[model samples]
Every structure is written in C-alpha cells, then in structure tokens.
Target: MGVKALLSKPLAAYVHKKDRSWIENPVEAQQAVFKSIVRKAQATRFGRDHGFSAISSHADFVQAVPVRDYEGLSSYFNRVKQGEKDVLWPGKPLYLAKTSGTTSGTKYIPITSDSISNHINGARNALLAYVHETGNSAFLDGKLIFLSGSPELEEIGGIKTGRLSGIANHHVPGYLRTNQLPSYQTNCIEDWETKLDQIIEETIDQNMTLISGIPPWVQMYFDKLMRQTGKPIKDIFPNFQLFVYGGVNFEPYRKKLFESIGKEVDSIELFPASEGFFAYQNQQQDKGLLLLLNDGIFYEFIPVEEYFKENPTRLTIGEVEPGVNYALVISSNAGLWSYSIGDTVKFTSIKPYKVVVSGRIKHFISAFGEHVIGEEVEKAMQRTMAKFPTVELIEFTVAPHVSQDKGASFHEWLVEFSREPQNLEAFTDELDQQLQKLNSYYYDLISGNILQRLKITGLPRGTFRDYMKSQGKLGGQNKVPRLSNDRKLADGLLGVAKL
Candidate 1:
C-alpha cells in the first residue's frame, strides 16, 4: 500500500470510533448540542428577543421561537446582511451562504466559525466511514474531484459570501489539496458549461478515483466524457471507485449513471444544504444516511401531514419514529433558530438515527386532494424503469394538469428520454401503475374517477437544460423539481416543450 493509504486506515478507524461515541448516545448528544448553541447565543439579539435566557427545555425553546422559512426570518437576516453584529449570532458571521430561493429572490444563510465544522467534518467523516468499513483507502492516493460551484467569494457586510459549495471550497483540507482536481482557476470559471469543459480537459487523463456532485451535473460530465473518448467513465478513470453525491435522490439517475460508468461502484449519498450538512450514508449496505446528532445542530421533526396546520407538532430527535415522513426543522450553531429548510425525511433506522430525504415540503403535486411527493414519483419511476431495461431517462418532472373544456384532469409527467422505450404507452402505463401503488391518495383519485391516468410528454433532449439556462440556474446545486402543485412550471415547460 502507498504511504497515504497506509496512514488513512488508522485515521478512518479513529474518526469512525469518535463518530460512534456520539452515534450511540444520540439523545444525550442532541441535548448537549441543543443546550450548547442555545446557551452560547443567549446574549445575541435574536436569542434575547426569543427569550433564550429563560428557556430551560424543548418546550420553552419552542414557545420562544417559531419555525420560520427564509421569508419569515428575512428581517433578522436583513439586519445581519447590513453589518449588524450580534443580530442573529454573536459578533459577525464567518461567511454567508448565498442560495437561490423560490418565493424570495436570494437567500443569505449565515455560516459561523463554530458551525463551519459541521459542514466540513460531515463530508470528511462520510469518506472516513467508507474507508473504515471497506478498508479501501487506495482512492485517497489518486485524484478526487468535487464538481461544485466557483470557489470565488464576494463580500457582503464584511463576510465572505458565495454558494454553499463555493464556500466549502475555501476549506478543503491541506492533506487532500494535491489530490483534489480541476485546478483552482478552472473551478472559479463561473459559467458551468465552460467550467465543465475545462474540468474534462484537466482531469481527462489524470488518476481520478473519486467523483462528487449532484447527479444531474455529474451525469452531464459523464456524457461529455463519453462523447470525447467514446468510452465509459470506468475505462477513462479505471481507479475511480467512489461516487459521492447529494441534493437529489440517485435512483432516478442510477441506471443511466451506471451505464455511463460501465459498472457498479460504491456510492455515498449526503444530505447537505446551504443551511447545514445534516446526514451522510455511513454504510455501504444501508440506503439510510446517518443523521449527524452531535454536530452543532439540534433537529426537530414535524409530521409532513401536519406541516401546513396552524401549529404543527414538533418532535425532537428522541421523539421521531421510523417510517413517518416529517418536515425537518433545525436550530443550528449557524444562528438559524427553529428554521425550516423545507426538506422532508423519513427515518429508516432509529437505532443510530438514519433517514432518507423524502421530498421538499413545497415541492409536491396536490392540485387535487391527492398530494404526491418527490419520493413517490422518483420511486415510481425507478420501479417502472427497472421493468424496461432498454429505456434510458435523462430527467423528468411531474405536474398536475387540470382540464378546462369538461375533460378529466390528470398528472402530466414531463420526461426527457435518452433512449426511447420500445413501447412508450406501456412505459407510461407501468409508471402510472407504480405511482398508484405508492401513493394511496393518488390511487383513490384515479380509482374514484376524480382524475384520469397520468400522461407522459417526451421533452426534447435538452429541454430541461434550456429551461434551466433560461431561468439562469444552469448548474451548481440547482435541480428541476420532481413534483409541483401548480401549473406555473407546467405552463412554462409546455411553452418550451417544442412538441
């Protein structure tokens, strides 16, 4: 074994052991994190305003602070952005993670010095967990690339501000600096297409062993590599053994990705966001990501069904149960209090608290009484795709289609197929059947004649890409919603469908 690989084994073991120390004591770890952040921020403006000093328990904390999305918390954020110290957390934020918001134009989430470790360490531990389990650290000696945003930073209120991925770039560990690929200059290229091209040029012949990114962007990279070399990614980088990804579920893209790779490779799924790094897949056999309990963040779960109610029941880590879908809320060291990141998750294992992100709270199709989520749609597509081995899907989205001319309404699935199924009608039928099996509400709607069977509209090869480009969200953590309730996206897509 190489020197780096030899050293990595013990390091991975140490990290894994330390992780288990907290993982085994979930409740205690979470309670400690909760109290620590609360006590530390007690003197800050937000803390004082929310009665943090008088708070003693979860109930007190809940009463003092209401769960707020970016819009609801904008006032406090505005103060911080305007150079107001101690407005949210103590003094000033180390950096502001700038993310695209739906209702709000742009959101600047605080990343404090104390909280930055949660993001950094979470990523490191994911890799360590893999190394410790499989005893395969040879990849550490080869080049590793994270297909992320520009590393360049702009200033806002004297705090470095950029996309979460970009902010993370500044903190890449010194040990892996040489192994990290796509030169700093290439990474800072701003335009995703240009950056991607440059990345391919730089690492096309390098010893690439690990590739990381959101699935869609990574798929784009693989597609370009195939065009250039006429070979699968495995042939291009024979040593490439790990695929680390986050932002979206990988199942929908799995077939296409594996085809591009030419073989199955061990992969890690991470649940990361601008708000905080919440979880990482710790074991190869498990689909559930191990939620970070002691990581300077206290988690809360509101049953997804109760999310829209006047006052949803907020359950702490200890109170959450396996199989129940919940809207994830967090009070983090990053100065976010009772913040709703909008993502929903269902716990798969509670022994060590592992969760699978179900969908976003707002990203669902409920035009009728049938509320179908991203997970359901993705799962349905996965099952349908399995039966049709020849079919290759590039991307897809689901939106409700309401008829105006006395016609029955139905869910319209906008799909971009790389390879058209032999029988498109059968494919659509299978997809619809899978969805009905997954979602009871959708099944009822279809059975009761409230809605017709779902319809599929094949979009042009680059329709979604063009749409994202038009919206100025072509890359870097941006993803097309899997499901939406309204016709706004559907109408916009229809306008660009070119059918």
Candidate 2:
C-alpha cells in the first residue's frame, strides 16, 4: 500500500504517477512484510506432519485453525503425490492450479513457490496501485487478457505442475507478457479441449488491454471473437482497457459486459484462488478497497459477527481495522494452513487497508445481497440465455427462499429440462425479465416482489445438480450452491425428488 500514498490519489490522477510516500509506509513496514508471509505461509501450513504453532486473536485463529475445504486439499493431495511430505506442504508443490472442483472432477490447486512469488508480488502490487490509480499504464498497454481454466498442467494425487493459467502464463516476464496468446507449452500438458480452439484463434486480432477471466469464458471468448471478426466489440479492441474480473458477482452482468464492450468497462476485483493470489483491486477503480495480498496472502479476516458462532472472528494482517465484515484466512504456499477460503469480506478504510467484497463464505444468498455466486448466477444465466434462442438450456440452479406469503425473499429458478417456450408462464416471464434488465437493485427487488418471490421450478425429470452427480457426490471439491438463500434443498426435492 504505497506509491507515495497513491500519488495524492484521485485514483492517482486516474492511473499513474504515484508515490504517496509509499502509501504512508509503516504499518510496521506492513507487518514486516506480513510477518514474512506468515513465516512462509506457516511453512506451507505445517507440513512434514503438522508442526508450526503460533496463535493470536481473531478468536485465536478460529480456535487454532479448523475450517478447510477442497476436502482438506484432497486428503493432502493424495499425500503430495507419494513423494510425500506428510500432508500439507514441505518439499515439492510449488505451482499447480489446474482447477475444476465442484466435486474434484479435475483437480490440483497447490500454488506454492511462495504462492508463485505471491502471484508475482500480487501482480506487482496491483500494478503499482493501478498505475498509481489509473493515471495510465495505458490501462496496461494492450494484450493482457486471462479468462482462464484451460492452460495445461494436470494432477493432484499424482502431482504435476503449471496451470494457474499455465503457471501465470509460463512465468510472466517475457518482458511482462504478450505474444498475443499461444505460448505456454512445456509440451502443453493439454486439456480443456486442447487449447480451446487455438485459444479462440489466438484472441482474434490481438491487442486486448487487461481483460481477465470468468464470465462464461469471457462470453465464450467474446462470441468466438465476434463471429470470427465480423466485428463489433468496439471493432475488435479499439484499445480496450481494464476488465479484470473475479470468480463471480459481477453486479448482475454489468449492463451486459458494458453492452458487449461498446464501452465503459475499466473493471477490477480478483481475490484469486487455487490456493493463493489472495486479494486485489484498489487502484481507485471502484473507489479503493480489497487490498491484502500482503506479499502472498497471510491474511485472516473472519467476522460477519463470528460466522454463525461455531466460533469465529479473526482479523490479522495487522488486526484489520476498517468497517469490519470479515472471513478469509489463507496462510498460503499452497499448503493452506489457517485455511478458510470461503470468502465474505467488508472493510472500508483504515490507513491502507480498504476492502468490501462481501459474500460467499459458502456461495451466496445471505439474504438479499443475493451474491448468487458461481460466477454471478453464471452471468445471470448467460445474460438470460442470450435473450432466448428457443430457450435451450441443459442445467441451472439458484435457490434462495423466504416467501411464506411474501414475507419477502427471492431467487428460485431451478431448471434443467432442456427446451422451453410453450408459454411456460411466458417462458417464466422472460426469465424474470432477464433478471430485471440485469439488476435495478434486482429490478426494484424482483419487481417489488421483494426478491424473486418464488415460482420457476421446471427440471422436468432431472437437476438437483443432476442429483449431485448420481451420488458420486459429484466429484472432488463439490459445487452446485449458486446461492441458496433458503428453499431447504429445493423444499426437500419438491417432496419426492425425481426431477
């Protein structure tokens, strides 16, 4: 948090020329570089058969750390692939992301080598405070695009590497990245359909300033880079600027990806995972917040009033401070120690702390703020099925309840039966008017219905996450909770299951 306090920040004059006295240096030198990344992510979360032990507040690190998913890193990633180091991390495991777990179907998450040099030092301190708050790194000189999940590297119980976007695109620094696309091929460990059709024809005509991933694969790589260049994404990148993106919650498809890139998209918000790259975005993009990448994630927020009291409340990275609303905890180096990557944040100001990504400590529906995650209801159901092409679909989910006669609470849309349109309640009322033209506070609280007010069900004969993958518990890390404000398992599977 420096660049001379963001060069007097108005987003640092809109994007460059920072030095606000290195963001008022000294929060004890940012906790001595977050206690040396919490003693190297607590030596990869107490590996070599559990060891390191140091506790302080935030309810004594959630009563000495106890909250892990990714099924406790797939039971210590099958003992770190037999080349064993006991469990968490000690010897190997440096970079490996290759994700796909909503039930560990395709895995590997590690991310060590000091969390890949803490994700390139948190992407060069969030691009030097986003070029000192948008003064302009030319919004990051063209050709950055990420939209990942198909780079290479494969393995977990077998242990391979590369894949956090091909090890950050084969270790970034090829003079900071840009040979248009195709180049991370250490024999390109192939997967996700062998380089997504030439990575969608090498990002169609190149030149893409900072666009990052996740939005139905960046609108299927911008609709196949706009029908193979018939053009109209501002003429294939008329100097496109910022557009980062996180796993979800893109404020209801931000006006359809800013009206399909016609303009205004200088975006941000990352909070990376696959075990690291902790938090980002604070170049005054949306007015400063979400900071702690603390030199490779050693953070630990946890507070939404002690997350339902099984005992919670843990704020580190120098005792948090701002407006509170926590829950993150990392420890990193791919060993995940004080682990609890569920997410749920909120902090607005405190010297250089800043933050506010509030949701998903377990995917959405915390009543109304409808995080509806899993990539914002997969971009509000692909912008409401791209305005219906015979309403074809093969899957869906979005439960959340509370309507005992409009006591108020919304979002229902269960779906799964493919085709539609025999006026099924006017095709479910134009898919709830395309999620209320993509959010007008969810279109005045679901048309004054006070949030989705029930009734969309469907699923004809399948879809309770395909019965949680016919009971294999749907693979590894397990998913299918794209927001469930209520509806207790879709009301006991509509009282009989079968659909």
Candidate 3:
C-alpha cells in the first residue's frame, strides 16, 4: 500500500495511531457501545419515545430479543434483497456479505452503514491493539491475501448488490484498497463443480505475502498447487509471511496444510462468521486472546457455571474476570441481538483480557448422552497426538445416533492417520478410550458398557479437502464443520465417495 493512501482518514487512526492502546474511559466506553443500536431503535423508525423497539436498557433489549441463527433472518434479508427496506437497518445498506447454508444455499447478510463503519474501525482497532501488544505494525505494509468468499453480487429482482468481501474491500481507505490481492472468487458461485474450478484457476502463481481463508479451502488450494507445479508451496509464495485462518477449529486441518507445504511457521486465526468479525488474534503468543470488540458489538459471556450447575452465569464485557469459561453472545450493529456464535472460551487473565479456547459448548456429540465438548475431545486428542509418531487425523467425527431398538449405545469415531498404524483399529480405539477417560461424563457413559459401534476408516491420499472442495464449499467464511452431534450427518459424510 502506498504511504499516501495509508495516511488517509479511515487508515490514519490505524496507520499513525497503531501504537496506542484503547482510549475511551469506563462510562464513555459503555455509552459508545450502547448507542450503536439504541439511537436507531428510537429514531424515525419509531415515532414517539422512538416507539420502534420496546426494550430500554442494553440488558433489557438483549433479554427481550430471543437468540436466533441464520434461518430466522432469511425472509427479512429477502426483503432487503428485493430492494425494499425492512427492519434490519434504517438506511440503504453498503454491501451484502455472502454466506452459505448447511444445504449450500447462499445468504446475503446486509452490511449496513453503521455495520460498515463499525467493521472497518473495529478491524483497525483490532490491528492497532495487536500492533501495540507486539510493538510494531510493519505487517500492515506486507502483501496481504484473504481466503475469502467470492466477490460476486446477486440481485433478487435484477439489481446488482455487493458481495461481503468486495464491499469490505470497497470500504477500505481508497489508498490501501488497491493493496488487497485480486480474488477470483464470485460470491454467488457456491456449488462444488463451478466454484472449485475457479478457485483452482484464480489462486495459481500469486505472490501472496499474507494468506487468509478457511483452513480447509486454503489447504486444498495449496495441495492442488503442489500437484500441478511439482514444487513446495514455499516456492510459490516466497514472500508469504503468515497464515490467517478461522471458521473452524484450525488444529484439525492446519497440521496437514503445514505438512503438505513441507514446513511450519507461526499462524493466526481470525474468528469471524457471517455475523461479523467477532475476535482477532490478541498477539500475545501465549494462547488465543479474545480481545473483546468493546466498541463494535455488545459482548456477553455465559459461564460454565451453568454447565456444572443449572443456572449459567452471564457476564457482560465489563464483568469478565480471569479463569472462567464463557459461551459468547453478541449484539452487533448489523441487528443480530443476543446471537450465539457456538464456541466456548475461558479468560486466562483480566486486565488486558486473555482467553484460551475451551471448546464448543452445545455443538458436540453426547454419545450415551455423556455431553462431550469439543474442548474435551480436542484436549484428549492433543494429549494422545503429542506422543504419537507423525500421524495425521484425516477425519474425526463423533456420532451419538444409536439403535435404541437394538439397545446399542456408544460414540462412533472415524480417523485416517498419515502413517499407517500397525494395528489401526486397536490404536484408534485405544485413543478413543483414552480421550473418553479424560472427560468424566464420557467416562461414565463408556464404563457402563461397550458403545454400539466405533469405527476407524483410512482415507486414501488427499481425501478431506478434496471432498470439501469437490462439494464446492470453499472460501473465506465457510469451513468443514470439525465437530458435530448428529449421527446421520457423520455417517453420510464418512460414506461419501472419495474425491
């Protein structure tokens, strides 16, 4: 990016003031966040007392609004898509971020004016704070590449709207905007055959200094690059400084990606879903720190106390303390109120707010109804993995579905390692039992009796990402769901023909 553009308005704060820490005082900090949506709720949308939304205080509004996922917002978004404004925001939106569904349908979430400004500034502040913590911002000047969704726009009634990444790029400081690498992805092209071919064509021969994307797609792209070029990935992008990934627990895919490239280096994960960029790397190098976007989205944490006890403790950003695991809830400028992002985190320290990824809260399997969390499973897997030979976990999914009629019960595990196991079934089963032993709940379930079915199947070379890409679900926001609770989904995924 040119120095002149980097010195412009939106970037000035990020570029020049990158060294500064957060500036707002306590009360002002609270108010700055509170007003992001409250003022709109009370405006012309509501005539008298801004009669629009009924909830008064922050907590009141949050309490009044029930949590919802993508399906709940579909119709309202369809209206915005039709070029008729609905209640998401008062003004015309700046862009629509493209996202996919479990069935692979496309979603164009509105990028409102407030949301645009909040995202840009919030990202800048995140970078600023990261630089402050690291003591420099030279990475900002490096060639940055995002593993993003397609930049294609769609119109319900023939009016061209914007894709999420394109709009985000469009809003960047005009000077540095051109600094972003060209994306060959089209937001609307989300099918297996059409999208993967384009991803393969567009991503070749680029000097990607900084790389970003869902880990599965990034890994898939690089594998294809290695096959066609017959050279290590390091040779393709010699300037590549870092790997930025998110959308799924990166550990599963990261190991394979690094191995495929024939090397390893430091990496960062940007945990952003279609909702908004929730958190970025805190730059501490200890563990992932969820530096709360104090001003962008009103953040809340639900304590594990609820998991242990009946009533969960919910803490606001201001109330967060050290060593407590929380299931996060967010209310953003884009109109998602008390939205659950489905991940669990624990604060390791307070003053600057450091956190370790605890696990997925309600998103894991409960075979024998044991309620094994992602963190529990991941921790056990990591422990066993740390001692094993250089083996890869090609696929691991837990399915709780049992034949109740047959009285069968157990967590079924499927794994494909890099180095062939001397006794594949025995080794994998022992690992499974060891993992179950670590989580007390799973232990009770298993100790009672043998599981209905526990299977381990080996994947032929290049199966995981090839399947994901062949299915045409590659890019920035989408990822291979690492952990799930459903048995059928697991079975179907495992049974699918190899790519």
Candidate 4:
C-alpha cells in the first residue's frame, strides 16, 4: 500500500465509526442534532420568543417557531449587521457572507465561529469518507488546487464580509497549505480575469493532485490550461485523482468537464450554502449526498406542493419520505432560525437520508403554466448535448419570452458556446424533444399549442464571464442562475452580449 494510504487508515477508521449509526438510525441521529442546536441557541432572543426553554419535542419546537424566509427574519438580521451582540447567536458573528440577491441587491448572512468549524469539518469528514471507501490518499501528498475567491476580506460592522470561499481561504490548515496553490497573492487579486491569469502563471507546472470549485469557473481554468499547455488536464496534472464540486448541478457539465480532463476521475458533490455546509457525497455507489444530521444545522422540510398554501405542513427529518420534493428550511449555528434558504431537494434514501437538490424555490419557469424547473431544463440540455457531441456549452439561462410581437410566447435560451454545433437547427430540435420527454406539463404546452417552441439565442463567447465581471461576482461560490421566470436576467445577459 502507498505510504499516504497507510497513514490515513486510522483517521478513516474513526470517520467510519462516527458515521455508522447516522446511516443506521437516521431519525435518532437527526433528533439528537435538533436537540443539541436548541440547547445551544436556547438563551438567545429568538429561542426565548419561540419558547425553546419549554421545547421538549420536535412538535413543540415547530409549534413555537414559525417558518421563515430571509425576509421574515430581516429585522433581526439588520440588528446583527449593526454589531449588536447576542442578537441571534450567543455572540457576535465572525463574518457576514455577502450573497447575491435579486431586487434586494445583496444579502448579508451571519457566519459564527461554530459555522466556520462546520464548513471546515464537513469538508474534512468528506475527504475522510473518501479515504475510508476508496482506500486511496496519495492525492494528499501533492497539491490540491482550490479555485476559490480572493482571501482579502472587507470589514462590515466590525466583522469580515466576503464570499464564503474567500473567508474559507484564511482557514486552510497549515499542513494542507503546504500542498495548496496558487499563492496567497494570486488568490487575492480581486479581479477574476487577473486572478485566473496569475493562477495559470503560478501553478501550471505544479504537482496538482486534486481540484475543487464551482464547475463553470473550474472549467474556465481547465480551458485556459489546455490552451497554454496544448494538453488535456490529465496530461498537465498526471497525478490528478479527484474533483470536488458544488454550488450547481454537475450533470450538465459532467461530459464537458471529463472531456477537458480527457479521462474520468473520482468526483464528490457537496451541498453548501452561505448559511452552512449541509451535506456531501459520502459513498461512491450512492448517487445522492448524505444529509449531514450532526452538523450544526437542524433541518426541516416543507413539501414543495404545499409550501405556498395557507398553514403548510412542515416535516422533520423523521417525518420526510423518500421521492417527495421539499423546500429545505434550516436552523443553524450561524444564528439563522427556521430560515428557508430557497433550495428544494428530494430524498433518494431515508435510511441514510441521502438527497439530490431538485432546484431553487424562486428559480422556476411557470409563465405559461408549464411549471418547468431547473432540473428539467438541465436534464433537457444534458440530453441535447449528448446527441450533439461537438457542441461545448459555456453558460446558459432560460427565460420566458412573453412578448406578443415575437410571433408566439415561448422559453428563450441565451447560451454562450465554447464550440459551435455542427447543425444549430438540429440541436434546437433535439433540445425541444428532450424537454417534452422530461416534463409532461411542458410537453402538454407544446402539444396543446399554448406555448411556442423554445427559441435559441446563441451568445458570443465570454458573454457570461463579462456579465459576472460586471456584477463583481466573478469568482468562487458565485453562480449565474440557470433559469428565471422573467426576462430581467436575460436582458442583463443581452446587454453584456451587446458590449
């Protein structure tokens, strides 16, 4: 066995032992997690007002706390942002993760020390899970390039404020730092195009063994490396073994990403938000990520079909069944209480509580009653790409085209392509066919003549990169919304294309 593998055996064994019962008794594991969080936050005002002192069961906690979106808790968050002490958590937050918002402009999410620990430990445990299952840790001996945001953070109300990835950059363990690249200077450049240029200059010849990032940004890096070296990613980093990705669904990018690498490599998917790192892929055979019951986040699920109704039912982990989509609600160490982070997920397994993210709650296309979701669009695009092997997608978004002067109202696609298709008309036809097969409502709309066939608007290359650059969201943990119901983001992309 390799020396790296031999050294990791004990740590891997410990992770397995700790996680065994979580898989064996998911309900109990989650209940323990809830109870711990309640006790931890019980002294806070939110807990007091919500009767956490008298809370003995999940039912009582539910009765005491009302379901809340970010807007519902904005008042408390305002206070926290103003440097109020013990407004939510027991102490002041260490940082505020600034995430993109629609009309609100930006959202400042509190990040406590405990929350940071949750993120760091969650990533470490995920790695340990990989080691335990695959019995391979040779990647540890070489550089693991994390395509993260700048390390330089801005101060807001005496707390550091930045993207989650940038905040995390400061906490990479010293031992791991020895094998991490690019240099601190390159990572802190602030401009993504410049940062990418610096990263290429610094690490192109390094002994890179693992890489992790949001898929699109990482793809950009891969493309740059390929052009610079005139080689596939595998040729440039011969020891590369793993790709860890999150922030968006990987299915649409999987084929292109592998093509860039020129070979299949082990990959681990993660589900993390600004609030907390929630879940990670734990086993190779399981397609869904294992819901992290013991992480500092207590989870609740509101059935998506009922979420908009009056007095909607909220289910705890024990009450949730497999195969139903639920809007995820979380109460975390970060001081968020009964907060809906806007993501929807479907449980694939209840025994281990594994789930796949279905889509975002706000990001769906129902302009014509088709109610198409991000997953459906992504699956359709994936199928379309499979049929057209030469087409390389850079980025895309779908929006409703409701203008009457446009002949017929339909879904409009704004796509930036790295490689042009052999036949664009054939590609559109295949995409439409795939959509009809995936969503019955969409199929009905097409067949019933209620909506026109989807329109494809090919965008020039670098369109998305330019748009993100303009928005100052050009790096790690930031992602373009894949599907929006209206034309707001679509118009923005069009403007950038014009530029």
What is candidate 1's CA lDDT for residue 106? 88
lDDT by residue (tens digit), candidate 4, 301-381: 999878887677988888998988899999888888888889999999887789999998889999888888888899899
Model 2 quality (TM-score):
0.31
lDDT-better candidate, 2 vs 3: 3
The prediction achieving the highest TM-score against the true structure is: 1
lDDT of 3 by residue, 1-499 (tens): 5454244435445543532334223334545676666666454222122243565575665455545545655655666677765356665566666666553277666666677676666455555554455544445565566655555665653334655555565556654454466444333465634655565565566556566676766766776778888887778766665676666677666667887767675566665555676666656475565554444677767876464443345567678777676887776667655666566787776555656666666667764666677776666666666556566665565666576654466565555455666666666676676776766766665566645435555656555545566566445555555457776555655656341
Each candidate structure's TM-score, on Cα atoms with residue i matched to residue i, is 0.98, 0.31, 0.81, 0.95
Which pairs clash (backbone N, Cα, C closer than 3 Å) in model 4?
none
Select the stronger candidate by lDDT from 2 and 4.
4
TM-score winner between candidates 2 and 4: 4
- How much lDDT does each candidate structure score? 0.92, 0.58, 0.60, 0.87
Candidate 1 structure quality by residue, lDDT tens digits, 7-115? 9899998998888888899999999999999999999999888999998899999888999999999999999998899988899999999999866788999999899
lDDT of 3: 0.60
Among these predictions, the greatest lDDT belongs to 1
Candidate 2 segments whose C-alpha is farther than 4 A from its true place: 1-116, 120-171, 175-178, 181-212, 227-275, 278-307, 310-328, 332-341, 344-359, 366-453, 456-499
Model 2 Cα displacement at 496 (Å)?
Answer: 38
Runs off by more than 4 Å, candidate 4: 1-5, 405-407
The ten-residue window of minimal lDDT in model 1 covers: 398-407
